[model samples]
Target chain A: MTDLLRVVDPGLYTTVQDLGRPHAISSGVPPGGAMDRFAHSAANLLVGNDIGAATLECTLIGPRLVAEAPCLVAVTGADCELLINARPAPMWSGIFLSTGDELHFGARRSGARMHIAVSGGVAADRWLGSLSTNVIAGRGGMHGRPLMSGDVIAAVAERSGPGVSGRELDPHLRPDYSNHTLGVIAGPHMKRLDADGRAALLGSTFHVSRDADRMGYRLDGATLRAAGDELLSFGLVAGALQVPGGGQPILLMADHQTAGGYPVVAVVVSASMAIAAQLVPGDEVRFEETTIEAALRVRRERRAALDSLRS
Target chain B: MPPPRSTTRVRIHPLGDTALLAELGTRLDTALNTRAIALAAALKKRRDVRQAVAGYATVTVHFDPDQTTHEALGSAIKRLATKRPPMEEPGRLHRIPVVYDGPDLESVAGALGLQPQAVAEIHTRPIYRVFLVGFVPGWAYLGPLPEELAMPRRDVPRTLVPAGSVAIAGRQTGIYPLATPGGWHLIGRTSVKLFLPDSDPPSLFRAGDRVKFFGVRP
Candidate 1:
C-alpha cells in the first residue's frame, strides 16, 4: 500500500465507496455505495482499475487534495471542472499526477455527485466484505465516515511500472443527467393507493425536495391518497418509491433503511437508478410506467455498454 | 391445545427487476413470521439468490437479473414455500431487564387507563418473538404486544432517541440499537447493548428469536 493523496479541503460529504455491501442488507445494514454506479465504474475503468475497486464519491462540491506520490487518477460524473496545480484538466480521462501536485475541483456544471478513482484503487477499512462506507452505522471506509481535512487516502497497490494516461471514455456512452423522467415498475403495494392516487403518481411531475441525500429523496407533488390501513414492515431496497401518511413520495436511495412500513407505490427500475442518483434538490422529475420485461432489457443494454468499455 | 397448522398461501410479487417479495401473510402472527423466516433461509441457499431478507411477514429475495428471471425465481420460491421444511427448533431466548422510568411511561399508562406499575407488569407478561431485524443496524422488531398495551406511535417523533431505549408502537416493541430519530412510545430503558458493530453478527437478536423483559430498580 502507498499513500496517494492527502485531503486539503474535504468538500461536501465525500466518502470512499465501492459496489457496496449487498450481502449485509439482511442484517439491517443499508447497501451504501456510490450513488451513481455508472460514473463510479466509468471512473474506475478510466484509471484501469476493477469496476468494483474503491473510489472517492464526492457529493455536490469536490475536494481539494495534494498528491503524496506519483499516481494515475480519473474523475467522472457531475461535470465538475478538474484542476491540476491551478491548471484546468479534462474530466472522464486518466491524468498522471506527480508528487506534491495539487488537485482541485472548480464549479460543478451538472449532476450532484462525482466519482474519482486512482489507478490502484482507494484503500479503506472493509466491513462485511466491502470497502464502502455506511455513515449511519459508522462502519467501513475511513473510520466509517466522510473524508475530513488532513486525512491521507492510500492506494491498495502502487503502479508496477510507468502508467498510461489519457484514457478517455466516449462522450456518447455517458449518462445524461439532464433527463428528468425516470422509468418505474409497479410495486407490490400499488393497489393500496386509491384510483386518483395511482393516476397522480404517473401523471404529475414532482420536485425533489431539500430533504435529499443518500438515504432517500422526498418528492413534493400531489397528495397521494391511499387506504389508511397500516402496512406491515417489509424488506426495502434502493429505488423503492414509498408513500407515507403525508402523501409525498420518497424514493429510497443507496443508503436507505433496509425495511420500512410505508406503502411503496412503485419502484424505480434498475436502468433508471443512475438517473435518479444524479438528481439534486429542486430538480423536477417525473415517472413513466414501464414493464418488468422492458426494465430487464434496458438493464442488459446498460451492462453490455459497460462491458464494451471493459474490453 | 396444540397450535393450529398455518395454511397461509404465499403470494409473490416483483419488487423491481432485480428482486421479488414473497408475502406469506399480512398479519403479524407468529406462524406467519416463522414461515417467512423459513422461506428466507431456504432462498439464501440458492445459487441465484444474492440475499434473502425476512421481514414481518415477507421474504425479499434479491438476485442478478442476468443470472435468473423473476418468473424463474418466483416459481422456485412457490415450490419451496409449499414444502414445509422439518420444523426447526425455536431460536435462542434472551431475558432482558429494563428500568420502567421513561418520560412517556406515565402518559402511556394514562392512555391505557391503568397504573404505571400495571403497565410494566403487562409489558413483562409475554415472551415476544422477533419478527424482523431491520429499520436500523442491530434493531430487532419483537411483536404481538398485548392488545391492552397496543398504542399508536407518538404524534411527534423524538429528534434523537437514546440507544437501548425500550419502546412500543402498534402491536410491537423494540429496543433502539443506536441513537436515531424514533416515533415509538418510550416506556423504559435497558442497560444491555443491542448493537455490537465489531461482532460477527453485530446484532443481539435475529428473526425468530424470543425476548422476555423484566422490570429492574432504577
Candidate 2:
C-alpha cells in the first residue's frame, strides 16, 4: 500500500464509503454506503478506479488534505468549490497532485454530500466485506467512524507510473441535484392510508425536516392519517416513505435500520435516490406517482449513462 | 407446542424496482415467520437476488434489476412458495440467565395485575422463537410473548435503554444490543453479549433460533 493523503482538517462527518455490503443486510446490517451512488461511481471513474472503489463521503462540509505521495484525484457530488495548493480547481475531472500539495474545499453551492475519489482507491479497515462505515454498529471504514485530523489515508495499490488525469464526465451525464420532484411507487401498505392521506402524498409539497440524516428524512407536510393499528415489523429498504401515527412521513435513506414497524406508504424510485440524497434540511420536495415499468426504465437509463462513462 | 402449518396465501408486492416484498400473513404467527425465513434463505441462493431478508410474516427480496424484473422474480417466488418448503430443524437453543431486577418490573406487574415474581415466572414460561433479527445490529425480535404477560409498550420511550436490558413490548421481547432509545418495558438484564462485532455472525442470535429465559439472582 502507498500512503497517499493525510487528513489535515477533517470536515464535518467525512467517512470512507464504497458500493456497500448488500449481502450483510440479512445479518441485520444496514446497507450503509455512499448516499449518492452515481456521484460516487463517477468520481471513482474519473480517477481511473473501479466503480466500487472506496472514496471519501463528506457531509455538508468538505475536508482539507495534504498529499503524501503523487496521486490522481477527482471530486463529485455537491457543488463545492475545490482548491488545490490554495488555488482553485475544477470538479468532475481528474487532477494530479504532487507530494506536499494541499487540497481544500470552499463554499457549498448545492447538495448535502460530496464524494472525493483518489487513484487506486482509499484503503481502510473493512468489515462485513465493505469499507463503508456503519456508524450505528461501530464497525467498518476507519474504525467505524469519520476521519479525524492527522489520520493517514493510504491507497490500496501503489501508482506504478505516471497516471492519467483530466478525464471528465459529460455535463449531461451529471445528475440534477436541484430537482425537487421524486418519482415514487406505491408500497404494500398504501391502503392503510385514508383517501385524504393518499391524496396528500401525491398532491402535497413537503420540506425536509431538521431530523434528516443518513437514517431518514422526516418530512414536514400534510398530516397523513393512516390506520392506527400497528403493522408487523418488516424488512425496510432505503427510499421507503414510512408514515407513523404522528401523521408525518419519513423517507428512509442509506443508513436506515434493517427493519421497521411503521406503514410504508410509498417508496422513492431508484432513479431518484441521488436527488433524494442531495436534499438538505428545509429543502422542498414533492412526490409523483409512477408505474413499475417507468421506474425500472429510468433506473435502466441511469445505469446505461454510467455504463457509457465506463467505456 | 410447535406452530401450526401456515394456510394463508402468499401475496407479493413491489417494494421498488430493486426489491419485492412477499407477505405470507398479517399476524405474528410462528408458522408464517418460519415460512418467511425459509423463503428468504431459498431466494438468497438465486443468482439474480442480492439479498433476501425475512420479517415476521414477510420476505423482502432485493434483486439486481439488470439480472431480473419484478414479474420474473415474482413468479419465481410464487413457484417457491407453492412448494411449501418443510420447516427446517429448529435452530440452536439458548438458555439465557437473567436477573429479574429492572426499573419497570413492578410497574409492568402492576399493569398486568400480577406480582413481580409472577410476572417474571410467566415471562420465562415459553421457549420463545426468534422470529426475526432487526431494528438494529444484533437486535433479535423474539416472541409470541405469553398472553398473560402481554403489555403495551411504554407510552414515552426512554431516551437511552441500556445495552443488555431484556425488555418486552406488545407480543415481542428483545434485549437491546446497544444503548438506544426504546419503548419496551425493561424487566431484566443479561450478562451475555448479544453483539460481538469482531466475531463471525456477530449477533449471538439468528432468525429461527430458540430462546429460553431463566431467572437468576443478581
Candidate 3:
C-alpha cells in the first residue's frame, strides 16, 4: 500500500508535526512544531507509529482526508465530529479506511488542538528529524506550510497487525484551554518590578489577543511595571512571560523565536503548557505564583501518567 | 584564567508540573551565563528532561512529570547553580554577508548625522555577539551596535520584511531569516541562508556565538 493521503481541504492551521526542532536555537532556528506536543505523541502511539513519527496536527478545524489505500487512523485531543464517506466516525477509536474513503473534520466547537494519527504514520520527509511545519521560515511539513485544499499527504502503508485501539486522555488531565489559570514562576527580571508591578501580575486578569500564534501570545491586561531600570537584551525561553515597555505580557510558545530582551516576569511550567496551547483569542487567563520546586514535582507526576497510558 | 568568582543572582520559579524557571540576574556577564548553560546542558542530559527554555538571562528546565517533581528538580537545579563549574566551550560563531542597503538606511544615517556608508562602516566595525534568538526562527539578535548607530524601531512595522533582510534597532543588528512582518530599520539584505530545516545543523547560527556582517548584493 502506498503511504499517501490526498488533501481535499486543509483545515485552518493544519501542519505536520512531531516533537520539534531541538538544540538548534543558537543557529537561530526556533523549536517549531506542534503546540500540543504531548497530544501529538499520544495520537502517534495510539496509531502504532514510532513515538516521534510525523503526524498531522489540526487546530480548531480539521481537514478532509481521502484515503488512497487501506489504512488505520485515529484522532485525539479536542473532540471533533468526524465522518467518513458521510458516515459518522467514532473519535479515539482506531478504524480502518479503504481506498476511496474520505474523512471529514468539521469546525471545532471545543478544544484548541486535535491530532490525527494514521497507521504506519504519515509518509513525509523529515527535516532535522521532524515533519513539523515552521511557517516563519517556510520549511518542513507538506511544503513547509499549512495543508491547503488540493494537497496530498502520503502515509507509511501499514504492513502488519491491526493498529492499537484508541484511548482517551485522562479526564483529570483534560485541559481547560478556554479558561486557563496558568501558574507562573518568577522570571529573571521579576525582581526588577516594584511592588505594584508584582501585584499587577498576580492580581489582574489578562486576555489572550487575536495576535496569538505559534510565535508568541500578545496579551492585553494591566501594565506590569519593570522592577528596576532597563534590561539589556538576554536569552528567552518558551514559557518566559516577558512584559515589554507596553506592560503587556507576551507568553512565548512553540515556534517562538530563540531570544528576546523584554523584562520577563514569569515562566509557565510544562504541566500547564497543554492548557496553554488551548487558549484562543479572547480567552481569559490569570497567573498564579508558585515555587519552582512545586512546579517540577507536578511535571514529574504528569510524565509518569503519560507513560502509564501505553501500559 | 577564570575571572574572580563574582556574585550572580538567580531567581527560581515554577512554570508547571514539567518545568522550573531559573532567572539569572541582570549582571549575567560571562561567568553567570556559563553556569546557566552548564545547568541547562546537564538537565538536557537526563532521560526525563524534555526541553530547556532559556531566555536572555533565565533558563527554564522542562521535564517529564512522572520521573521528577518541580520541587525535586528545583532543588537539584539550585544546588547546581551554587558555584558550579563553568561551561567548557561556547557555541559556534558565524560571519554573514549582507547588502547594507535597507529601506531605513538613510533615515538611520541622518539620525546619526552621517552618510549611509559611514553608518554601515560604523555598524560593521565590531563583530557583534549573538545575545539571543527570538521573535522568529533563525533571527539572531546581535547586539550593542555602535552607540552612534542606535535608532528606534519603525513606528509602524512593515507588512513584510523579505527573508535575509538585515535591520538594526538601538544597539542591536540582525537579519530576517525569512519573509515576515518586522519593525527594525532595514539597512540591507543577505543571500546567505540563515535557516534550513533539511540541513544537519538547520540554523546558520545559534546563541552564544559571535557574528560579523559583510556587505553583499542581490
Candidate 4:
C-alpha cells in the first residue's frame, strides 16, 4: 500500500508520459509519449528518480493533487504557477510535502506543457512494454486514460522516505518558450521543393496553427508545397517537416503516425524538440536550417550540460 | 545484353542522435518488409539498439545515444543489409468469422460487378497475410485485397466507424478494433475480440500472420 494522490480537478488535459512506446510504433502504435522528452527527464532527475520514470504530463492547465502520503515532488517544463495548499511553491526543484497536503497548479505563466515528477516515480500499469499513456488507444498509464476527478494515483510502494528538497537547476539551461526558433536539418526529401517552395519554408515565419495536437504541429505560414512530386508513404521520424497537399507544412511530433505520404522538407533537430513541444497555437516560429553534424553536436552538448547537473 | 535487373538497395540515414532510418526500397515492396524484419532481428541482438520500428520500406532503429553513436548504429545497419535474414515460416492461418452485411456491401458489390455473396467469398478465399499493424491498435493491415474486391478509399469517410468493423481500402483490409473516423469501406463485422488491452501479447495478430475471413450469419 502507498499514498494515494487523489485528483481534485484534472486540469485542462493531463496524461502520464515517459520516453513513450518507441518499440510499439512499429506495431502501428503511435509513439505516444512525452511531447518534450528533455523536460520530462529533467523533472525526474531533479528528484533523484530515474529519467524515464512515469510523470504527470500536464498540458496547459494542471491538476490539483492532494497527497495522501508524505513524499517529494518536482515540476518542470512550461512554467506554471505551482502552489502547495494555496501558497506558492518552487518548480524545477523537489518540494517536501506532508500527508494530506494539497498541490494546486494555477494558470500557466510560461510554456504550453508541464511535467510533475513525484519522488520514486508514480506506480502505474505498463502496456506493451511502456507506462506512457496512449489516450487515443485508451491503454497504459493509470487505468489507461487521463486522470479524472477523485481518481487516486498510486505513489510508489514506499512513499515516505528520505526526500531531496529545494535543489533548483541552472537557469541558463531552462528554455523560454516565448522565442520559438527551432533548428532543423534539411530533408529526407529536401530537393523535392522548388526554389520558391524552399524560400517559403525557410524564409517566412510560421505560426503554430490551432490544428495542432500530440500527432503534429500544423503550421500556418507561407504556402510551401511539393514541386510536382508524387510522394509515397514511407517511414516518418519525429520532428519531420512535411508539406501535405494543402501547401501548409506539418511538423510531426512525438505522437506522429508511423508513416506518411507527404514530402518532408526538413526535420527539427533533436536538440530543439523541447522548443517545438512548447509552441501553443498562435506562437510564432522561425525555422533555422542547420547541418546534421551541427545538430548532433548540439544534442551532445545538451546531454553533457544535463550530465553536469547530476550530483 | 541490357544490364541485369537491379536489386533494391537499402539506404541508411541518421534520424537523430537516438535513432537512424534504413530505407530499404524507394517503393513499397514485400522484399523491403523482409529486409526490415531481418534488420530488426539483427538489431535486437545489439545491446545498444533498443527498438526497430519497421515501416513501408524503412525500419527506424531507436537507440540509446549514450550506449551507441549514430555512426556505430549506421555501420551495424549497413552490415545487416549486406547479409540478410531468411524469412521465417509463414504465420499460421487464422479463421476470422465476419458477418457480410456492412453498410457498403451493396455499393462495393455494384462497383466490383459482383454479387454481395461473391464479395464475401473472395474476401475469405485466400489466407491474407498481415503486412503490418498500424493506424490503430489490433488493426492489422492484412492484404493483397484480391484484385477483384479492391477499390479506392471512400471520398467521404464516416465520422464514426464502430469497433470490430471489417473494412477495406486500396489493397489493404483490416478490422477497426475501436470506433474511429476512417475512410475504409465497411463491409461487415466480427465477434472475436481482436484486441484485449489487459492480456499478455495485447495484439492478437503480429506482423506476418495470415488470416482467413469467413462469413458468419447472425
Return the TM-score for candidate 4, rounded to 2 decimals.
0.91
Question: How much TM-score does chain B earn in each model?
Answer: 0.95, 0.95, 0.86, 0.90
Q: Candidate 2's interface RMSD, please?
A: 1.0
User: Which candidate number has the best DockQ?
Assistant: 1
True contacts kept of each: 0.73, 0.75, 0.51, 0.37
lDDT of 3 at B167: 89
lDDT of 4 by residue, A93-173 (tens): 778888899998877876788888887887777888888887766778877888899887776545333566887777777
TM-score of chain A of 4: 0.95
lDDT of 1 at B52: 95
lDDT of 2 at A258: 87
lDDT of 1 by residue, B1-218 (tens): 98554543778888888998898888877877888889899889888999999988899889988778988998888888888755867889999999998878999999999999998999999999988998899899998899999999999999999998999999999999999999999999999988888775778898889999999999
Error at A4, model 4, angstroms: 5.5
DockQ of each: 0.78, 0.77, 0.41, 0.44
Each candidate's chain A: what TM-score? 0.96, 0.96, 0.90, 0.95
Q: Give the residue spans of candidate 4 off by over 4 A.
A: A157-162, A227-233, B1-8, B67-71
TM-score of candidate 3 to 2 decimals:
0.83
What overall lDDT goes with each candidate model? 0.89, 0.89, 0.72, 0.79
A6: Cα error in model 4, Å: 3.0
* Model 3 per-residue lDDT at B29: 56
Model 2 lDDT per residue over B88-137, tens place: 89899999999999899999999999999998899999999999988888
Tell me each candidate's TM-score: 0.97, 0.97, 0.83, 0.91
**What TM-score would chain B of candidate 2 score versus the native chain B?**
0.95
DockQ of 1: 0.78
Residues A208-268, model 3: lDDT tens digits = 8998988789998887767556665544567778887777789999877666667777888
User: Pairing residues by index, what is the TM-score of model 1?
Assistant: 0.97
